[model samples]
Target: MSVQDYTSRLSDPASRKMGTFSYLPEMTKDQIRKQVEWVVKHGWNPAIEHTEPQFAMSNYWYMWKLPMFGEIDVDAIIAELDACHAANPGNHVRFVGYNNFTQSQGANMVVYRGIPV
Candidate 1:
């Protein structure tokens, strides 16, 4: 086949195009809890963000609020995600782990996929 066809075969346009965990299947609530738990175990601060599906691959996303400092409860984090999703039902919701020491992102994954507007 042609190079364009070969490349297209290797890439899935249907997949979620977020920063991390994009290659994996859509994460369930339990999986999200596990990921948040890992973030807490690593002492990484948690944050939430959202964006329109069309902007999912964009570099910038609207932060739900300030990065949650010293957040240890996974349920609270999930609740914040829920709140953001409730407010922006038409936007994709994601959870992120921020490393204060590194001043960079540790991990991020899309937890909820929004309906296309």
Candidate 2:
């Protein structure tokens, strides 16, 4: 499915569901591994840690934060951000692509939530 479809699906309140990354790119592997490792080491149950992987999750630098966690499929990650944008259409959505000239492939789609009240 296209990112738009994923984004649309994310808005359905019922669509907030669990999911995982199909694969982590070499550049992101270490960080992703650490997040997973935290779950394993602290004995945090997967069911509890990654409460909602399917949609509207944030792409925090370190990963593993609740109501949402894990690396997630890039497609799914982008979709979640898109969903957030959809929910607040008037607000301009911006992003810092994975790798800027100076950055090390830290590409991500970050959607700052909400419109001005």
lDDT for model 1 comes to 0.83
Residue range 68-116, candidate 2, lDDT tens digits = 2333344443454455456545443323222223433232322332222
Q: Which ten residues in a row have the lowest lDDT in candidate 1?
A: 4-13
Q: How do the residues 50-72 of candidate 1 rate in per-residue lDDT, one tens digit apiece? A: 98876666458999999999999
The numbered model that scores best in TM-score is 1
lDDT at residue 3 of model 2 (Cα atoms): 50
lDDT of the structure predicted as candidate 2: 0.35
The TM-score between candidate 1 and the true structure equals 0.81
For model 1, give the RMSD to the true fold. 4.4
Question: Which pairs clash in the backbone of model 2?
Answer: 98-107
